[model samples]
Target: MKYSETINSLIRKGLNEVNHSINGHLPLSIRREILQTINEPCVIGKISISCALKVYPIWNDFFKNDTEIIGLIKQSEKFLLGQINEKELLGNAEHLEVFVQDYNKEDNIMVMFAGMTDVHAAYDVLTSGGMEECVSDEEALQNPDTWDTAFIASLAYNGGAVALDAINHDRNKEFWNWYLTDCIRIAFFNDKLPYPPTTSIVSAKYFSGNNIKEYRTQPNIWKENAECRSRMNDIKGILVKIMDITHWTKSDFYFYHVGTASYTQVFYYKGNELVKFNLDINISMYLSRKVEN
Candidate 1:
């Protein structure tokens, strides 16, 4: 598809924005607009699914016969389409959470990156949230679900880029810089959400008893949509804010886990002291911010 001059300009701007920054986001006004339009929790879940599919090849091959991840992805999409209730979806998410916790992928960077994408997809249960934030350039909204969702989306979309960075750790090349320019990911333009790809992963052999297409959760989207929109708009009107602390620990091995503050940690000796570091969605951050105002 041909990009309009405006979109081409925006893409170029996005490229430059990520060129030197550790983390960046669309402007606050634009982000707010996106949050406004996405009142349906399923919409946010769709965002997560599309991002997760970005590294589908890596995920598909790395796990071989273990189709639990694909099953989870399929379940998630089905849930968004009203094929499953929240209780059932939560059960599936818990099962995937346990699977991710048991799998060990930290030994290989490629597996680790792709594995993280799966982990993030499971977390995209889409009981979504967006906080009403204070007026400050330092913030990109601090709601727990939204902040964590942002991180989840990043890992899903950038798993390949991160794997490339690992491969070229010694060569000092930035694959992320080129990854964005090489292809125009359709998800960035149009969305086929709530529909996981009808790939080989969903063959009857893989889908089997897990299929729930015939039993929609039967939500009344027409009535719920109005309520959700009003509620989300109220969240936007909030002035609550958040603050968090970055922390580190010491360990001699690698560890990875999913759900809640899911994290990946690798230890390296800093002059004889092995240290591990990670970011967390500390509730204290939000509590402190809310208390302060």
Candidate 2:
């Protein structure tokens, strides 16, 4: 299942509740409440997918290829949620940066998860622990930064990356393009950013050996070293950490886990030791989380 479906299904449920409460037509207040309930998740999902697609047009294209994801555009009703189409979302994000710059134009920007999966999942997780209620709309709106919106987006983005990796491995050039593009999108959206996005290599972990050397010169060193092993393990650790942190959204996260890379591996040689090492362990990440402002 795609992120869009998770959102659409949730909205339908909420709307159904509103519909059942009233006879023919809902009153303005009831309508407003219903719209509010539906809008946040829809907008969150749209912005997340749109922002992600901006970085990874291939991902957007993948969704375009996936009939279920593209189906959102076919809905007759219009809302902030449905407005995001795969193409427009993937369209020149760098170009769109100008508009955002003109709007809030502040370096001290924060991202909030508005999509259905993150918001609802986070709320459920939190509330299940015994909070008086799930995070209030007022609270989410008041401080989007504190909300787990990007955390949810992180799950979706990373989930897609894992799937694409498995389907074609590194051979899927299109998926790599999509992966890198989505990486850029997460960086931009989460960082509250504009671009031509600036990037500095945080770190590079490589995998290399006879098998890998045939692929590249100077050999990618992901495979055979204690250090590489350590780093790769670190990557795994981080992924699990994020997973544990977002356990509340586990079910939602699982939905997008399809078609993304969950872990990665590479071959490396250290001294006499020859081993297959994993680089970043085949997981997708929000670069912003790993970077410092």
Best by lDDT: 1
- Over 1-293, each residue of candidate 2 has an lDDT whose tens digit, in order, gives 23345444544553454344321111223223322333444333343344333323222322223332222222211223244443443332323334323423111111111122222322322222122234554554345343332223332322222122122223323322332344323423443322222221111001112221111112124456666556645655665665466442221111112212222333333444444433352233432122211
| Clashes found in each candidate (C-alpha, N, C closer than 3 A) | 0, 35
TM-score of each: 0.44, 0.20
At residue 202, give the lDDT of candidate 2: 13
lDDT of 2 at 69: 23
Which model scores highest in TM-score?
Answer: 1
lDDT of 1 at 7: 46
Looking at candidate 1, what is the lDDT of residue 104?
Answer: 39
Tens digits of per-residue lDDT, candidate 1, 1-293, equal: 23455545555665565554434333344333343444445555655565455445445654666577767777777777788787877777776666655543433333444445555555665465343455333443433233333333343333322222122221111333332343233334444543334444432222123441121111223245765455434433331211112222323322122222322233444455554433244633442233222
